[model samples]
Structures are given as C-alpha cells and as structure tokens.
Target: MRALARLAVTTLLVAAPLTAVTAAASAVADPTPITVLTSDFEDGTVQGWAGRSAETLAPSTTVAHGGTGSLSVSGRTATWQGPSLDVLDTFVKGTAYTISVWVRTASGSDNARLSVERRTGGVAAYDQVAGNTAVTSGGWTNLTGRYTLATDVEFLRIYVETASTTGAFFIDDVTASYVPALPIQTDIPSVKDVVTEFPVGAAITGAETVTEHGQLLAKHFASVTPGNALKWDATEPSENTFTYTQADPLIAWAKAHGTAVRGHTLVWHNQTPAWVFLGADGQPMTATAEDKELLLGRLENHIRNVAGHYGDDIGVWDVVNEVIDESQADGMRRSTWFTVTGLDYIRTAFRVAREVLPAATLCINDYNTNVAAKRDALFALVSQLRTEGVPVDCVGHQMHINVSWPSVADTRAMLQKFVPLGVEQQITEMDVSIYTGSGESFPAPPADRLLQQAYVYRDMFALFREFAGEITSVTLWGLADDNTWLDTFPVTRKDAPLLFDTVLQAKSAYWGVVDPSKIEQTPPGTSGCAVTYRVTGSWTGGFQGEVKVANTGTTAWTGWTLTWAFTGGQTVTQLWNGTVAQSGTAVTVTNTSWNGAVAGGGSATAGFLGSWTGGNPAPTAFTVNGTACTVL
Candidate 1:
C-alpha cells in the first residue's frame, strides 16, 4: 500500500547525524544474577553453543566483548548461519529475557545478529525476536535485546545468524535471563488532541491488512495522505488512462471519516509514467520546441485532470517533489522534466495546479531540507519561483530525522528561515529515525535514546507550536513502527521512527510531545481497577504484553480508563485494537465505547510491545474511573 519508489535521500546527501555512542567493549547487565539460566562463555569451550547452518564453530581467545573466550565461526557466507541453541526446557516461559553478544568481523564489514524464537504448529509456526548491531573491521560491538515468551515452546532456537555477505566472526559474553520490565508513565494526553494549530496526520497505504493501524489513524489523525495511490503511477498506470481504483477508496473513506485528504505529488521525478516523458517515437524528449511543448502540455493536463477532479477535496497538493538535488554544487537534480522544459517546468506545474484548485494549498515538497546546504538550495528555488509570480502556497520539509542529528533546534531554524518567503511550512513526511547514521543498524536504541527521541519530538512540536503562525500542518510519514519505509532505505535495518510502536502502542516519545512533565515516573500497580498483566512474548530488545481489565467491584464501570506506570524504561510500541498512551512511567489504557462497559465481574484486554533496559517489571497498580483497584 505504501509507495516503494520515493527518492532515496541518504544516498545522495550523506549527512552523518551526531552519534555519541561507543563501540568499545562493555559489560553486559545481568538482571537476574541470582538465577542465571545461561553461561556467558568466559570458559574456552563450545559446550552450550551450536550452529544450525554449515559452519565450523570453536572457542577463540582472539576477541570478546566482556570476558576471555568467544564463539568463533568460519567458512560461513550466509548472514543467517551463525549460532543456535535450544531453549525449550532450559528457559522459563512468560518472562522477559535478553541476549547480549559482543561480536566482530574477521574480514567482513559486520554480519552477525542474535535471534531467539519458538516454533508452534501450523499458522503459528516459527516466531522469534531478532536484534543486531554493526561491527567494524577491527572493533568489537555489544548488541542486546529483550523479548517475552508466551508458551512452553518445545523447540526454541537461540542463534546468531549472519547475512548473505558474511565471513568468519567471533561472538562472546552472551547472557539470557529474565529482566524485569519497568513500569511506564501513562497519565499524559494524546499529541493529536493537544496540538490544534495544525492538523496532525500520517501517510497510510492499505491499512486494511492491519486492523490496529487503521484504528490508530481514525482516532489520532485528522488528515490522510495516500502514500502511493495518489501518485501519478498508481492513479494513471497507463498513458491517458486514469484509474482512481487505488485512490478513490481513500478519498471516499476520508470524506466519510471527517478526515481531510492531502493529494500527494501531482508532479514528481519518480513514480511518473514513462510515457509522460517519452516522445511519439518512444524515445527521450528532444530539445526541440515540440518536445518542450509536449512535456509541458502533459504536465498541465495531468494537473487539471487530478487537481481539478478532486478540487477542494484535496486540501493541499504536492505540486512538485524532490526538484532540488544536493549532489550537484547548485543543488538542482538533472531530470527529464528539467532537461526538456528548463526551470519553467516547476513554475508551470504550480500554475496549472493553482488554476484548478485556487483555494487549495499548493506545496512544493522535497526530502533532506533539514541539512543547511540543501535547505539553502531549496529556499533559493522557492524564492526564485515566488519572485516570478508562481502560485506556490507552501514549502514541505520531509523531516525524516535521526535521534542524534538534525537536532530539533536546527530543524526549527530551517522552518523559520522559510517564514520570510510568505509561504507556510509543513513537515510533510516526518518520521524520526533511531539508526546511529553509520548506514548500519546499531543495537535497538536503548531506553535513554528512546527518551532522547521523545525530547527531540517535544522540541520539534514546541518549535511547531511556537511557529503556529507559519506552520500549517505536521504529518508523520507513517503511524506505526511496521508501516514505515525507514527499514528499507540506504541501509536495511529495523528502526523505530514513529510515535507508535510496531505493536500499535504509543511510546514515551508520544508523551514528550503531549505533556512531558506531570507524568509520574513510577511503575504500575493496582489502584482502583482489577488489572492483570500477562507476558505474551519477549526477545532481543523488545517484548509483547497483554493487560486484562476487570471491574471486580459492585458497580458496573462505564467509559472506563485504566492507568498504570512502569518502573524500568520499558515502552509500549504497539497496542492492539485499543487506545493507549504513556507519560513517564504511567500507562493509561482506555477502551472504545463498545468495550468500555465492564460488568461487576467482566473484563477487557489490550496487548502491546515494549522495549526495556535492565529489567521488565509488570505494573503493580491500576486505576479505573479514578478508583484504585484492590489487587495491588
């Protein structure tokens, strides 16, 4: 459902975000030191380790993350061929645990990932938690992750799998034990309801497959941008053949849901049909007036057909996307449109859009405007178009950010810089990345980093709130962790960039934007409502949990809101089918109108995924309708 063909910005403009993390060897946390289930392999032996793939394994003293010995694998080229261990009878089920490995490559860039999984029969077969870290040629990197176990798995595999381009590697200091999850702060408000100056939204594609994703969009977002359907390729797959099949449903749904639609990209360098830029003979457009006129006419016709059809339904249209390429000294990308029609192509595209939807906002969108040089070049182009009397209404900075770099301060400066142009600004495709900018996946961002991401989010929203006069809208690229494109970009890796977790639950970062303070930093406990916390699954750096709510009182609870907090820095990434949020350690879970009525003995349940540091502690307290449950 998502547009898989957007311009790749990291490859063209390699701006390394600030990374203060260390790759030096470090000690791993032993959360359950009293009842350690596994060995760290400090002894020079492979007694507890085995390889599932065809790999030679032996104990090595060459390098280790913590101790003296390490598991060495050689003659392996596949990335998924490193290590495996059975945990069926040795590990406890329904508890959070982690595996930390210090690893380095023998000759490769980096190629080892630790995975723990269980296999059930049929459709439920082969589920696991996987987390990895990048290793330099000569340095050792520590990788860690937390996951939960739901059932008594008879066949479980704890393995370090290498990628396709793997060589020999050494792994050491592996530890897996139950770590108590910290209770999260859960008393904060939702970012969408709190920020009113600009409507909040996310780009969605086929939210049908995941029911929770659609529910989150319906509850939190006021606008919708079909990431790919509205593009020329999806809307007009064949020349002169406009198919609203992919787009019509989204628009109709938006109108019915009281959500506005933002038309994504009437004109763009990518996703445009080849025929639009091809001549009658099916070749490149010539510099002749015919080719120029042909391309210009096609551009105008496309704008009229699309913008004119939707008209006011599309509150704003990305008239042009990614025209400024920073690879060139002047920061202008060379494309067929620019070649055939010169710079007038952009101006003409905007003119036609303005003519069709005069009242709708027309925006020129691009990625990587957070970088100063590219930002300046973008301003230069927009300034030129404005000086020429083009009908450009707003500027879109695709704020795909990282936790360490492009600090919110820098982003605000860029937004403020465009205010003088008299055009409004919108963070068009905003998703903050968690990768540490080395083009390689670092271990899952630790809790502190996630909190730091929350602070950055607050600063960003604060900037937006401060500049409410100039900022019109702020759209998160995607709503949930699993719906984003950050995982498939310049370097393929798992990244938590959005406010909601992969499980569709809110993160601490969500609180940073809503109201940072006032969220109590304490673990959850039973206050006024009977709340039951269950460990469904946990592995690597994350875990899945379920909460059951029961009235367990004489009165029937209606319109109930359950609240709890975590002691550790554990965060909820995704919450299944229910509305949930976090402040610090407090977790507030509210039911839909359908499920709000819990009778004197009835219950409701909601599930979520969480990330933890030293421990994963279940909430001890919960309150429903301002009454503390008696169970805690």
Candidate 2:
C-alpha cells in the first residue's frame, strides 16, 4: 500500500528567551530540504523510486505532492538512508524550534525508525530527541517533534533505519522553523483549460439504424462519417471507372464545421468491386496474373485519387485498416490486399498517400489491441515499418471496449508498451456497449453501466493525463447512443458508450469531462428548481445574504412577508452559512453561521446558480421587511 503523511508545527512564545549567545555567534540553521535516502534506487522519477533487496545503496525519496526521486548506497547488505537535514552546524540554548516532514512506505515491510538526534562535541556520539512507531500504510502520515536547544549540543541528524530488508520509502515537503504552525493547502485540482477549435475528425453512418440521438451527437463531435464511404463497390462499380458521389455529403458537412475528415479506407477485401476480381479476358484474379495487376492498379489509383481530393483538409487517412490477425504469417491479416498485392500493398498504399496528401497523418488502425497476441503482432508490423522507413505517424487503437472485456490496467499497460515506438497513440472509435438478454456476458444494467462508464472514462482520462505528452487526443466513435454503431453491429441492441443519452440528455459520463463533485449547482429554471430551492434554503456557508418580501398592496390577507434580493451576480447554489424560510409574499433568509451570507439586510437571497455568461442584471426593485425599498 502507498501512503502519505504530513506533520505541521505551530508555536506561541511562552516567555521571553534568555540571551545566552554573543552577537554574531548564532549558528547557521539546517539548509537542506527534507530528503529521503535509501538503497534500491532506480531513476530520478517517482515511478523509478523502488526497492529490491539484493542490491545495496539505493532507496527512494518522494518530492513534494507525492512526486518521488531516489538515493542509494553500495555494500554487501545494503543500508537505505534518508535525512531531513544532511548537516546542522550550530545551537543556542532556550530557543524553541519545530521540525516536520511527510513520510510513507510505498511498497514492502514497514518496520523502520524515523530518528532525530543531537551530536555532542565533535565525535562523542549522539542523543535521541524523539521517535515514534505509530505509522499506517498506504496514506500520508504526519510525523512531528519539537525541542529546545541545549547549550552543549552542536549538530543534529535525522534518518530512517530499518531491520526488515525489503520495501520502499518516499518523503516529501520537509520544513523546519522557529514558529509552531504550518500552512495548509489542498491537492491541485485536475481541470484542464477547455479550448475551442476542433482538431481530428471522423464520420458515422447507420444513424437511422441506431435518429436525433445520432444527429445531436454529431453536432457536438468533431466530424461525421458516412460508413462504407469508400467500399470498393461504391467507389469503383466497374473495372476501369471510379466515382465519388456517395462520399460527398460527409466531406461537405465536415468542411462546413472546420473538421478534419478521415477517409475510412482505401483497400478492403469484403467490398471489392466485381470487375477488379476479374481480368479483361474474363478470368478471376485467383487464377491469372493479368487480373492481379489490374486489381493492384485499381487499388493504387483508388488510394491516390480519394486521398488526393481533400488534400490537407483531411487530417488522417486510415492507410491500412485491420491488417493483423492471430491466424496469419508475418503479422499480416488475411485480406485480398495481402492475397493479391501481397504484404507490399501496405507500403504501396502509404507511398501513394504520401504522393497525394503529403501532410495528412497516416495510420494503421486496428482492434483487439488489448489482446496480447494481437498487440504483439501490431508491434511487430509497426517495428518492421519503422525499420523500412515507412511513413506511419500514429497507431490508432480502436477501443471498442465492453464491460469485463479488457481490464483498465491491462489496457493502460498495453498502451505503455507502444510508447517506445515514438509515434503518437490515440484511442480512436471508443465505445462501451451493453446489449440486453446477452446474459452476464453483456454489460450491467443501465445504472451500473452508467457508473462503470464514468469510472472507466475517469481512469482512462487519468492515464491520458499521465501520458499527456505522448498522446495527442482521444476520439469517441459516436457522441450518443442514437448513432453508435454498436446497436446493429454484432447483433446486440446495447446502449452505446458516449457522453449523452438517447434524448440528448447529459449522462453521468458527461461528469467525466469535469469532476462531478465540483458541480454543486444546476442551471436555474429547469425542472425540480422549486424542490431544490426548499432544500438549498436550509443550508449555510461562510458568505451571507439577506431576504425581503413585498405585497405590493394589491393582494390582501397575507400571514407574513419577507423579501430581499442580492446585489451583483451572486448565485446561491448550495446554501451554506445561511438559513431561509418562505413567508407570504416574500422569502426571509438569514445567516445562521459565523460566516456572513452574501452581505446582510439590503442584499437579496438569490437561489439561481450564477455563471458569467456575458451578461449581468442589477436588482431594480426590492422589498425588505414588507416595506418597499429602493436601491440607495
């Protein structure tokens, strides 16, 4: 278990210190930042700070915020050492001082002593100040101690010594001061700055099969695809002629949205036009050389022309798709391209694409990457391409994930292995589908599936954050269930993995975009606003506000009245530090806690969630204590 602990030292002077040292004779204080030294040192990064028992001299040290670094020593039985202060030079009697540091055992046995001692007169040995054995695993634990300087002590040393051989230690943020108190701060939030321009794009067809659900999704997404855009039959229905009418709408829509389009495929076996399968003399390519050359020529021309049309507007071209299978030699999937143009077809397609769309990113997109064998095959193919100097720029891992498919950890590890290749990795076409009546093999129920979706999205994003420099982007196949291909593919009517549901409502997965715990307010005027109002009125916070009510003298027989409105755009979402009650024509809210609520009396208690959406409205009228009050 990994752990983090912190110790804060604060002080109040009990009395005036008795002066014992002459002016200019005071000792220099400890200068080194708290450092944990140990054997089994790996590398400088925290991930490399690890311990293995056989080797001597290297132990791990964690920097601030749980980041780790390493230290090590050399000998027969290794000794791992870490010090809060490497050397301390002077001491003055009667001055109170506090020292604190955070420590944790990342992995291994926890029997170790964190010691502080004073060295007396050159080499006369040391005396202990304080030590503690109360420590827990897997979380930050604070260790602290205070002491008054003695007249004779000249040096101080702090370290960790252990009898148990195997384990790792990490320390961070060491501080020592004359004052007794420490500052407090929370972990840095992980929200990223949202940017507006769209980058990569792709389209989806079969929306009618999945209506509005798909269209709404497409509107929010970067690109759209008319599935089967370049299938052989559609692009080249005859032996020598090619056409582009079927794929124009997708390109047109993508152009209007400033989206980068992706050409679905250039070479595929399943949809080969019938003419390419036969020779001019009427013989199929399976038995004749003339037919094979014609097929290859057609394939090359198709790639060059289709990819050439859009030029730089298309960001990526799926130069080769699904070209690896377990039951193939040299890691090439069995396809007509391989059977006819042979494995060289891959190199040829890339060469042709380079000649055409010279700036577009070229990728070999594949699925089943989570499976080791398939992934290994992909690695080998990409390695061969790199060795041959093929112009492949990215590896598209088609993440068609489902519940209980590839575990998140395994998927992350699989991606990690590809980092060495030095090409951008992207999770393209991601979806988590749950089909009904598929037994336990299918995903869980909608509620559980939603939660699982949120967890997976969060974990995946966290992994992406860790590898942000290496990964360029993550693109979901569809934005909502309406257009997701999962419904018809594989014959399962599953809910598609996406941020929005069928009715275009944001799902819990949308929370994955930002931490849901941070979303404390709902947009005002939506359904359930009144119920939420009643609940929020009872809450209170450090800030305070006042309430007012007015009858306007038109409606009679009022039991009570209270009304007041807030100044500025102060939105009261969750009411902390206040109390609110509705009486007659107005609502009277009060600050019940020590922290005032949004400024008292003249201010109105606004119940709406406030957002700076480019406009503001100042209060024009107010009713305080049943008396009409105008802004002063």
Q: Report the number of the highest-lDDT candidate.
A: 1
Candidate 1 lDDT tens digits, 1-632: 12343311101001111111111111122122222444456667886778777788998877775457777888775667777777777665534444445677877675456666455453122322333356665887755544444344457767776555668887775655443422222343555678898998888654421234445677778888877777888667677677665567678778888988888988887888888888877898977789999889888888788777788888888889888877787778888888888887898998888888879999999887878888999999889889989988999988877787787668777988898899989888887787667554532333445666787787888888899999889998876654456654555555678887644556767776777763222222344345556554455566656666655555787778878878888898778647889998888888887888766545666777678888886666667777876431
TM-scores for all candidates: the values are 0.56, 0.48
Q: Per-residue lDDT tens digits of candidate 2, residues 285-358?
A: 65346656776677788776677766776677677778888667677776666776666778887888888887
Best by TM-score: 1
Q: How many clashes (backbone N, Cα, C below 3 Å) per candidate?
A: 63, 54
RMSD of each: 15.8, 28.2
lDDT value for candidate 2? Answer: 0.48
